[model samples]
Target chain A: MKTLTVDLGDRSYPIHIGSGLLGQSALWTPHIRGRQVMIVTNETVAPLYLAKVREALTAYQVDEVILPDGEQYKNLDTLNLIFDALLSRTHNRTTTLVALGGGVVGDMCGFAAACYQRGVDFIQVPTTLLSQVDSSVGGKTGVNHALGKNMIGAFYQPNVVLIDTDTLQTLPDRELSAGMAEVIKYGLIADAGFYQWVSDNISGLMRGEADLLATAIERSCACKADVVGQDETETGIRAILNFGHTFGHAIEAHQGYGVWLHGEAVGTGMLMAADYGYRTGKITRAELNGLRVMLEQAGLPIVAPADMGCEDFLSRMRIDKKVMDGRIRLVLLEKIGEAFVTTDIDTNALNQTLCAGAQLGY
Target chain B: MKTLTVDLGDRSYPIHIGSGLLGQSALWTPHIRGRQVMIVTNETVAPLYLAKVREALTAYQVDEVILPDGEQYKNLDTLNLIFDALLSRTHNRTTTLVALGGGVVGDMCGFAAACYQRGVDFIQVPTTLLSQVDSSVGGKTGVNHALGKNMIGAFYQPNVVLIDTDTLQTLPDRELSAGMAEVIKYGLIADAGFYQWVSDNISGLMRGEADLLATAIERSCACKADVVGQDETETGIRAILNFGHTFGHAIEAHQGYGVWLHGEAVGTGMLMAADYGYRTGKITRAELNGLRVMLEQAGLPIVAPADMGCEDFLSRMRIDKKVMDGRIRLVLLEKIGEAFVTTDIDTNALNQTLCAGAQLGY
Candidate 1:
């Protein structure tokens, strides 16, 4: 396993990336301090990996809550299911919750851990590329609202994040490509060398190349850990991590959550941000085209929805968490490996981008 | 006016106890960060102090969410009302939430603020003596599940705790007596002098003597602050703060919530703990009798519910957050003005207390 630590003083923990981690009970045991373990997964993940985790935690009192899979299910109503399961079973504060699925499960379970008896111990076993690269490492846990994505969440860290690359074998081609969007986001927002490497090995990643996948997961987590370590709650530098998220979350919310996968929206949002950057002279036309081509080649939508207009985008973005003191601050790219947050965005400029079909709720 | 600070570094905030604080906008103004503010209260509180708070926050864009009154309303479903209000109005991250009511309002609003967009700025305008002396000072915020009281919550501090003792002038006699339970608890667990003072002046407090009330509030807050400063998340010393809570929460939960006021339940729970202490030779029978007399004189219950059996108490108490490693750890009184936590409790002693119609969730 490749270990990367998110340095958060006393709250810090290791992010382990490797194959067959679910089968490795040793990696999952020590972190669970309490004997009562609640494994929160999803309908899709339960049949595949739930038993593996259950088997690994044989000696402990294990309780399982399998929620409906998908972004649409990521809401307070669904979160109640996890709470109900834990409460009905008389799970105590000392009980350890293990999130055993993708970003949605991890986010919801981590949130349940956060609010369960004011807080409880939770470990993350991320089973998707998006989670392996982004969501699982950061302490950001929440459910979606009708207004915005990730708006109802907390900055609660995990005890450990176990990423088993072997699980990616079951990932559909589209899902794998969707996960690649976040993988691309990591490179776009911070690491130029990784971006170039991704450009060269995109085929290998899509083909589930183990060594390439491990390296990508490692570097992505490292970049994210560094950013999260500096700012856990997105006060300043951490906002850069939401480079494409503002647009992405809006796209998801407006399109009815599950319509567009999180990575799909983020992938398209990144392209739109690049376009806006180009229009505002923050990036060269060639840079914008390069990002557009890379995203399209990765099988992501780069245009606005046929139905949504500037007003729709504006309303959706207005309800976002990034709207600070009424101004919709956005993460705009200056170059492929660089992004910055700015509130000086002109509506006229934004209208043009929104009219062009896309640049970014709960 | 008097102020006490809960020194928790960055999370540290002030607790202001005085008359006319609510009328003075300046006291409530500084803590509100953004121009937008949401006041979360109950139907009962809205009729009483909502307009007063509205007058104070006239300079800002304000919204209000009035929930049904009582402890039964302090649940996730009711909490959704706050989220709905925030989302419907498009309240952003910078928006501030003002909790205006008693402990239930403060708790639900504080929790809503804690989870809304993963947390927003919140100010506590506690109207009850119970809240002002206890809940308002601590940053612990959350709602309850059917399985337990305060089962779903967070350890989120408020920007400022506004305790307008003037509001207590309109408080009913029963509510006043209920509030006294917590005031007496502060003295029982840590400050023997405060305990003696309460013993000496119970009638004055019941009579609503402003000076006496202020002193009780100040002293209770001081003892609570001293303990909470040492342990914010109940890892150690803070558990002592829950001396009566284990039994109290079970009483609240088993009774279908709102049947027994939180302080009332704690009052009975404290007597139960004292009885258990006496049974185990941890405290003198004389000490137990003394605390019981004080609670009884303060107009609080000193025994368990008549309808509840030993099994019910056992089951409900088993669901408590303090149950670590499968052993139900309890906060026990070693003697008057002193307390400690122990999992070494005997079930026979516990059952005997429960059968005795006294002694110590969803």
Candidate 2:
């Protein structure tokens, strides 16, 4: 078992990573402040791990809401289901909501907690690799809007994030690879050694080797925690956390939310950013190739959709949350393991990068 | 103009009170960091005050979304319109939202700002006296659910609260009385002198005497600011701020929202709390009568809806946000100008208070 603390002063919480931690009451009970516990999960995860989580929360008045699975369900209409269940059960301000699925579930539940009665306590019990390595650590919780992804949300931190690695064993291979994009992102934005380590162990991590996967999760969260602790609300350096997210969000928005998994879009988005870096002479060809090879080895997408043109990417990117003063700010790589946000894009160069399409990162 | 600051460290903002603060660019422009400004107003307020607000923001890229007026529209479904307008306008994280109506507009816009791209800057331009005295000073921003009022929202503070008292001249007689319910409340919970002053000058204030209304607004905001600064999230002393809200929410939820204005319900609720205080020997009968007379003189309801019985009140109050565990915690008056929250209610006494019907606060 490995534990990493996201130090956020009063909002600080621990990320507990290990196998079979779901049924362990001692691991989560201390975080459950109120007797009324509502477990928010989805249809996919409910049948698998809901009972284990329910078992751990027996001492409290437990209620559960099982939402339809998928990124497409991550919107305000779907988010209201959790609120309905809470109101029907008379869950009060003291009630603590437990998010028990992947990123979609965690994001909705955390946001529900934030808005329910003007904010309540919520604990994250992430059941997927993408969530464990990414969503669970950051306090960014919200639902997606039809116009854009995560356009409606809050930065409400969780009481604790209990990551039971045993649940990842049930994740599909595609999902596993998608999670790797964020894991690799940690190395790209902040840690060169961690980046090299992720590249070296990419295949094993994809294969779900417990120790390697656990190590990757720990390192990724630690790197993210360090960044978030300094810039909790993304005023400055924290924007780098969305390194590939601008282009990734464009892909997600263009292709429809569920068409490409978030990590998959981000995986390809990182490659595009890397290609832009290479074209701008910020990184050597070998550095760009190194990132491309890692993403490919992890079985992630390396390019934007062939049909998505410069306008498609440009139009979607304009509405992204990262845009400021009508200028789209993107986190582009200066080098592998180093990224910076800039609105100083040359139109011709950006058009070339966008028009790169299938040839991106080749 | 009288300026009072709600000292919520870092999130602190000023409450500016006087005539014609709406067109003063110096007051609100300093608060708007971004060039894109979205003004959210209602149909009622737009025809009157929207043009003035727009004229003040001529320097920025201004957009406006006019929602249907009334508290009946204060729900999640209606809240979505703001999101739609924001996304369609390509408003980003830096965009500042100006709430230019009453409480409904302020609450929805503030919650929209809080959730839009995980928070943004917003200014409160409260037109109604109800909003100017209460909602603008407190950061309690949210929409209502069918099951309860204010069931979904956030404690998002504004950049500043500009109380243009001039707008109150156009306010209806009913709305003016409704606003007085909150003004009277400030005296009931924290200021005996203010309470007496409101009673002695109720008719003049209700008749739209500018000086008296301005003084009332200042005192109400100052009292609210003091309480909010002490307990922002209602962990302790701040619960007193909701002295009548628990019972008030029950009435509002039972009668259907907007059927009775929020302040009217709260006025009756305050009477009920005072009745409870009298029955419990916490205050004299004379004190209870004083509250009833003031509510009556102010043209506010002094009794709960006749159809609403003990069961209806209990059933709805049980789901209120103030409930902790299965116990319903209520803010009951200890005296004319002091209140306390308690979960220790004797069934018989509570039933007597609930069954008071038309005799309530008499």
Candidate 3:
């Protein structure tokens, strides 16, 4: 296993990435401060992998809260279920919570840990490539509300993150492609070479090649870790990490969560951002084409839904957390692998790009 | 106006404590980052004082979320109402939430702000003595759950805490007495001379003597501020602030929220802890007697309910957030002026103390 330290001083933790890292007592036991541990997962993942986690945690008294799967379940009601289980079992502040699934589970469990007795230590055992590379690393933990996705949450870092690529063997093809969207995001934001690498290794990655998969996870995590270390609260440099998210979150919010995978929405959103960047003369048409080509190769959508109007999209994007004051601030690319945040883009230019991207044939 | 700054560096903010301070634009407007501001209040305080607060913000766009009165309403359901109102009005992260009532409103609103888009600036406009003297100063914001009091919350500090004594004129006698419990607690745990002062001026304080109440609030806030400055996350010294809280929270949780005023339960719990302290040889019988006398004089309970058994109380306290590794940690008074946290108290001794205190006539 390869370990990367997140460098958050006392709140810092290790992100262990490799195959079969889950069930490694040396990685998890030291972080377990209390005798009781509660593992939070969802129905889909529980039936598939809960027993292995339970067996691995036999050294401590273990309790499980298996929730129904999907982003629709990531709400206050679901959060209360974990709270109810913890309170019923008399789990105190010292009891650690183990998040055992993808982004949905990680966000829900991380939020539950944050709300349980104010806050507690949580261990992230990311099961999907999407989570292993992105959501599992950042301390952004929250649940979505009916009005918006991730409307309620806290920036709480986990005590430890255990990434087991072995679980990816069970992830469906659609989910794997969705996860690759975020993997591609890291390259788009800061690493041109890595973006090119992903472009070259797209097929190898899709084939479940371990070495390439590991490299992608590590590079994405390292990129995220560096940005988080500089701006843990998403105040400055961290906003750049959300290069495609403003448009992507709007799509997810408009289409309804769980309809399109987060990575898929981000994938399409990144393409939209690239097209917008090209239209604004900040990026070359060739660079935008390269992004579209790679995403298409990964089997991800490169165009916005024809039914989603530019006005509605703009309105939805305006409410994004990244928007400050009345202006919608977006992280736009100046070139391939170089992103910058700005609210200065002309609305006419953005609208034209949105219209153009929407009409593009898939 | 007297301003005491809770120096949390970048998170540091001033506590403006004086008569009619809420009407002072200089104290509030600077903190208003954006034009949109939402004030959260309860039914009782709204008709009486909400207009004045709204008028004070005449230069900016203002909205109000008027919730029902009492601690029973401090929950996720009520919090969701605030979130709904903010979203319907399109309140972004720049939107400031001004908590304009007692602890219930302050906590619910602060927690709402903390969770709304991760977090937003929240200001405290405390209308009750209970809130002004205790809850308002500290950054401990949370909503209560049916299983436990403050079962879900975050340690989020306010941008400014505005205490206007003019609003206190409408407070009922019972509410004032309830607040006195926390004021007395600061003396019991950290300041012996303050305890003596309260003992001497208990009748005057109960009668709403302005100078005496001001002195008490200032001293109590200072003591709390000192502890919080050293331990913002309640790692050590701050736990002392929960001296009677473990037992008190259990009482609140068991009796059902709003059955007893929080300060009323804490008043009784403080007496129980003093008795426990004496039984464990950490405090003198004289100190315990002083605590009981002061509480009785303030018209607060000095004992637990006779209906509660030691086992029930023990079971409830064990689930407290302060519990670590299955052991119940408690804050006990060493003397009138000093307190310490310990888990060493014997169960039998605690049971004896509970029995003794309950037997004392209210």
Candidate 4:
């Protein structure tokens, strides 16, 4: 078992990673501040882990709200379902909300907690690799609006994130590959050694080796926690954590949410950022190809949607949260292990990258 | 102009009060950190003051979203209009949202700013006296849900609260009186001297005497600012700020929102709290009568809805944000000038107060 604490001062919480931690009441008992608990999960996840969570919280009054699964349902209207459940059940300020699914459930439940009666205690029980390594650690929680992905949300932290690795054993291979996109992101953004480690053990991770997968989750969470602790609200250096998100959000919004898994879009988006980096002389072509190789090996997409044009990417990217005034600010890689945010993108290079088809990493 | 700062550490901002300050760009220019501003107003207010505000913001790229006026529209559906407008216009994180109407506009816009791209800069230009004295000064922002009022919202503060007393001149008689309910409340909960003053000059304030009204607005904001500064999230002393809100929210929710203006409902709620206080021997009958006289003179409701049974009040009050562990917590007057929150309630006394009807003060 490995535990990483996201040190957000008073708002800080721990990310507990291990096997069979879900049914262990001791692991999450202290974090449940109130006598009442509401477990927010999705249809797909409910049938799998809901009962385990309910049985664990047998001491307290428990309620459950099951939402439809998928990123497309991550919007205000769907988010309201959680609100309806809370209000109808008369959940008070002291009542704690437990998010019991992947990123979509975690985001919506965390946000619901943030707004329910002007804020309440929230806990995250992430059941997906993408969620455990990424969404669960950072306090960024929200729903996606039609105009853009994650356009409506809040930076609300959870009391604790319970990551039961046993759940991943049930995750589909495609989903595991999707989760690896973010694991690979941790390396490409800040850690060269971790990147090299992932490169060396990519196949082991893909094969569902418990030890290797656990280590990757720990390292990813630690990196995310470190970044979030420094810039809880993403004012300065924290923006670096969004290395491929700008480009990825463009892909997600243009392709329609749920079409490409968030990790898949980010996977392709990172390649796009690296491509531009290589063209701008920020990173060597060899480093760019290395990232592309890792993404492809992880069973992730290495190319943007064929239907999307330069204008689609450009227009969608402009609506990104990183955009200031009318200028688009993007997170670009200086090399395989370092990334930086810049507003100085050359249109010609960007256009070529957008126009690049299968020739991207060549 | 009188300036009072809501000292919330780095999140602190000022409340500016005076007549004709809306045209003075100098007051709000420093607070706007962005190049773009979106003024959110309602149909009732736009035709009257939108042009003046737009003319003042000529130097900046400004956009306006006009919503239907009234408290019934203060729900998640109307809030989506602001989100839709912001996204369609491609408003970025740096964009400042200016709430240009009353409490409804300020609450929705402030909440919109809080959730738009996980928070943005917000400024309040409160036009109604109800907004100027109460909503604008508090960082409380949210929309109503079907089951409850303010069931979905955030404690997001604005950069500045621009209160133009001049706008009150155009306010209807009932609306001006509704605003007085909150003004009277500040006096009832925190300032005996202010209560006495309101008693002495109630008619003049109702008649729209500029100096008296301005002083009343400043004093009310100062009281609210002090309470907010002490407890930003209402964990402790701040809940006292919702003196009549628990009872008030029940009225708003049961009667259908916008039926009784928020302050009017609060007016009756305060009297109910006082009635309970009197029945519990917490205050003298004379003090309760004094509060009733002031509310009556101010043209505010002195009784709860006759159609509402004690069960209705109890059921609705349990859903209040103040409730904890199925126990209803309420803010009650220890005396005319002091208020405290307690979950300790005698069912017999509470039922008596709820069933008092027009005989409340007696």
Candidate 5:
């Protein structure tokens, strides 16, 4: 197992990347503070991993709350179930919640800990590639609102993130591509060399080469942890982390959450942002082409839905977290691996990008 | 207006105590950071104070979410209404929410501010004496859950607490007595001098004498703010501020919230706690009589509800925020104006106090 720490003083925690962490008692026991343990998982993941996790928590008084699976179920209504189970069982402030699934489970459970009794300790045992590389590393936990994605939430960090790469063996191919989009986002916003490494080894990641996937997950989390450490709350530089998310969240909202996986929308959103940056003359067409090739190389979407237009996109994007002072701020690429947030953009250029692949009726 | 600061370093804010603060835009404008304003109030307070608050924010774009009045409405469902309004209006992170009512409105709105897009700035425009003296002074904010009162929440502080003492004139007589419960609590737990002052000036306050009421609000807030500054998250010293809350919250929970006003429940809960303190040999019998006489003098209940018993109290108390590691912690009066938290009390003493008012089937 290789360990990487997200350097947040006092709240700092480790991300353990390994082949089989669920069966490892040491990784799970230290973070479990109280005698009572509430394991929050989903229907899709419980049958496969519940017994193993329960076995590991043998000494503690363990309880399980299994939710229906999917991103669409990620909302305030579903978030209530975790609260219900914890309260009905009379879980106190000292109780520690273990999120034992992918991003949705991790996000929902982490948020429940943040709000339950003001805040409680929680462990993120992220099972999928996307969560292992992205959501599991940062303390950004929240549920999606109908008008926008992740609108109601908190930036509550977990005690430790136990990433079991072995769980990736069961992830669907489409989900893998979604997770890759975020993995690629880290490289696109910060690391040029890492971006090149991912581009060169795209095939290995798709084929699920154990060593190659482990390297990618470790590198991605390191990049995220560095950025998050500099800015815990997005008052300034942290806003750049939402490079493709502004457009991505809009796509998720209008397309109806879960209709398109978060990663797919983000991958497509990156393409849209790359095109917008290129049209605005900040990014060269060649750099935009390189991003398109890489996204395509990883089986990611390079186009917005063929039906969405400039107005539809604008209406949804305007409500995203990226918008500030009524101006829609977006993470636009300056070069292949360099990005900047700018609200001052030419409307015609934005329209041109919006009308590129979709029917805009201009 | 007499101003006192909560002194929480960078998160520190001032509490403005005076008559007719609602019409004072100068008090309202400095804390409001953004152009977008959301006023979260209730139906009862809407006709009374909403228009006055909106008038004060006329320069900025304002929106409102008026909930049904009462404690029964302080839950996740009502919290959703605030989110719906904010989302529907596309209120950004820069949006400032103004909680323009009593403790219910302030608590719900403050929790809303804490959760809305991770968080946003909010001001507490407390319209009730209970809110001005107790809930509004501290940064504790949350909505109620079915299993427990304030079972789900965040310890997010408001940017400012705007206390308009003039609004107390419109408050009903019962509500005024309910507010006194907490006023009496301040004396019983931490301020002997203040307790005697209230005892001597009880009629003036009951009659809503402007000077007497103002003095009581400021002193109560000062006591609360001092404790909160030392322990913001209720780790140790802050728990003492909960004096009668272990039993108070249980009474509130079992009485079907909104039935017995929070202060009334606390008043009765304080009585039960006083008896327990006496039985445990922590306080003199004379001290216990002083508390009983003062509560009766304030028109507050000196006993628990006739329907509850040791078992009923135990079951509900187990789910309170004070419960840790399955042990129920209670705040006992070491002396008038002083209290401490302990979980090592004898069960018979607790039962004796609980069975005093309620006819238990023993």
Candidate 6:
């Protein structure tokens, strides 16, 4: 297993990437502090992998809360279930929470852990390729509010993130493709060479080549770790890590949550941002085409939905967490593998790009 | 106005105490970071004080979300209303939340502020005596879950707490008595002299004697500040502040939220602890009697409900946040002014004390 550290100092944690890390009990058992453990998973992941996790946790008293799998379940109501099970079982601050699914489970469990007894130790056992590469590495824990995504959460780090690449064998092709969006995002925002590596190894990753997958996950985690270590709160440089999320979140919010996978929305949002960047002369047409080609190759959408108007999209985008003081600040790529946030774009140009993207049938 | 600093170093905030401080815009305007502000109050408090607060914010753009009054309303449903208003109007991180009611409003608004855009600065304009002395001063923010009281929350402090004693005139006698329970508790757990002061000046306080009320509030805040500063996360010393809370929270949880006022349940819980302390030889009969007399004079309950069974009460109490590693740690009094948390107590002694108190018809 290759390990990458999210260097957040006291809040920093290690992300383990390998084919059989989940079977390596040594990686997680040391972090389990209490006898009682609550493993939070979702319906999609519970039946498939919860038993292996439970078997691994046999030395400790384990309780599992299986939630309906989707972004729709990521709210206060669902968060209550984890709390109910913990309190009903008399779990205390010492009780450790194990997040055993994709980003949804990780975010919910991480947030529940954050609020449970003020805070508790949580280990991430990500089941999806997307989560293993990205979400599981960052300590950004929270649920989405009706008005915005990730509006209610904290920057709470986990003790360890157990990323078993083997679990990706069970992920749907669409889900695998969805996660790649984030994998590509890491390279797009910070590592141009890594972006090219993803382009080079897309097919090998699609074939579930373990070595290639391990390299991608490690590089993505390293990029995230470097950014988070510098700006843990997303105040400045870390905000760049959200390259396409401003538009992505709006797409998810506009389409209604769960309709499209988060990474799918983000994938399309990244394309929209590239077009916006190109229109504003931040990137050349060649760079925009390269981004589109790479995203298309990864099987991600590159257009806004035809039914959604640009004005409505703008309205939804305005409420994104990154939009400070009511201004729509978007993370736009200056070129492939380079991005920056700006609110200075001309409105006519933005609308023109939105209009063009919508015509392509998002 | 008498201003006391919470002494949290960099995070320390001033607690302004006096009559009519809410009307002084100069005291609040300087704290407003930007042009937009959201004032959160209840129906009961809004009709009475919202206009005055809005006037204070006349220099800036202000929005108001008037929630329903009572502890029952301190839930996610009500908190979402604040988010709805903020999102609908595109309120940003710079938007400050002003809690304009009692504990319920302060907690709900504070929790809302904590979750809004990850967190925002919130100012407490505590109208009720309970909040002025307790809830508003500390940063404990959360909403009640159906299964438990304060079962969900975060320790997010406010930027400032403005206590206006002038608003107390409109408070009902029952609410005033409820608030006094907390006032008296400060003396019971930490300040022997303050306890004696409350015993001596109960009548004056009940009769709206401003000087006595001011002294009591300041003393309570000082004690809370000291405890919180020493242990902000409730690891050790802070547990003493919950002297009556383990049983009190259970009573509140058992009877259903809003069925009994928080202070009323705490009042009864205090009596049970005093009895337990005396029986266990931690406190003397005279000290126990002193607590009873003060509670009686303050018109607070000094015993548990006759309808509650010892077993049921024990079950509820065991689920309290104080329970660590499956053991229930209780804060018991050693004297009128001193309290200590113990997990070494005999279970049978606690049952006998609880059963004895139930049979007393208090």
TM-score of chain B of each: 0.96, 0.98, 0.98, 0.98, 0.97, 0.97
Q: Please give the CA lDDT of all the candidate structures.
A: 0.87, 0.90, 0.87, 0.90, 0.87, 0.84
Q: After superposition, how far is residue B160 of candidate 2 from its true place, in Å?
A: 0.8
For candidate 3, what is the DockQ-based docking class?
medium
Lowest lDDT 10-residue stretch of candidate 2 chain A: A330-339
Higher-ranked by lDDT: 1 or 4: 4
lDDT of 4 by residue, A1-362 (tens): 78889998888888889999999999878998889899999999999999999888899989999999999999999999999999888888888999999999999999999999888889999999999999887889999888988888999999999999999999999899889999998999999999999999999999999999999999999999999989999999999888888888988888789989999988988899889999999888888888889898999988778888889988888888888878999998888889988898888999999889677776
Per-residue lDDT of B1-362 in model 2, one digit per residue for the tens?
Answer: 99998988988888899988899888877898988999999999899988898888899999999999988999888889999999999998889999999999999999999999999999999999999999887799999988788999999999999999999999999999999999999999999899989989998997899999999999999999999998888789998888788889899999899999999989888888888888889989888888898889899988799899899999998898888888888888777788888899977878899999998876
lDDT of 3 by residue, B207-323 (tens): 999888888888888888888898898888899999889889888888889998999999888887877878778777676777788888899977687688888788898878888
TM-scores across all candidates? 0.96, 0.98, 0.97, 0.99, 0.98, 0.97
Across A132-231, the per-residue lDDT of candidate 3 in tens digits comes to: 9999987999998888788899999999999988899999988899999999998988999999999999999998888999999999999999999989
What ranking emerges by DockQ with the best candidate at the front?
Answer: 2, 4, 5, 1, 3, 6
Q: Score the docking of each candidate (DockQ).
A: 0.79, 0.89, 0.76, 0.88, 0.85, 0.59
lDDT score, candidate 1, position B141: 89
Candidate with best DockQ: 2
Mind giving the per-residue lDDT tens digits that candidate 6 earns over A195-235? 88998999888777878888888888888888888988777
Candidate 1 deviant stretches above 4 angstroms:
A358-362, B358-362
Model 6 per-residue lDDT tens digits across residues B19-65: 88877889997688967899999889988998988887798779999
Interface RMSD of each: 1.2, 0.7, 1.2, 0.9, 0.7, 1.5
User: Candidate 2 vs candidate 3: which has greater TM-score?
Assistant: 2
Q: Residue A266 of model 2: what lDDT?
A: 95
Clashes of each: 18, 0, 0, 0, 0, 0
Model 4: colliding residue pairs: none
The residue-level lDDT of candidate 4 at B114 comes to 95
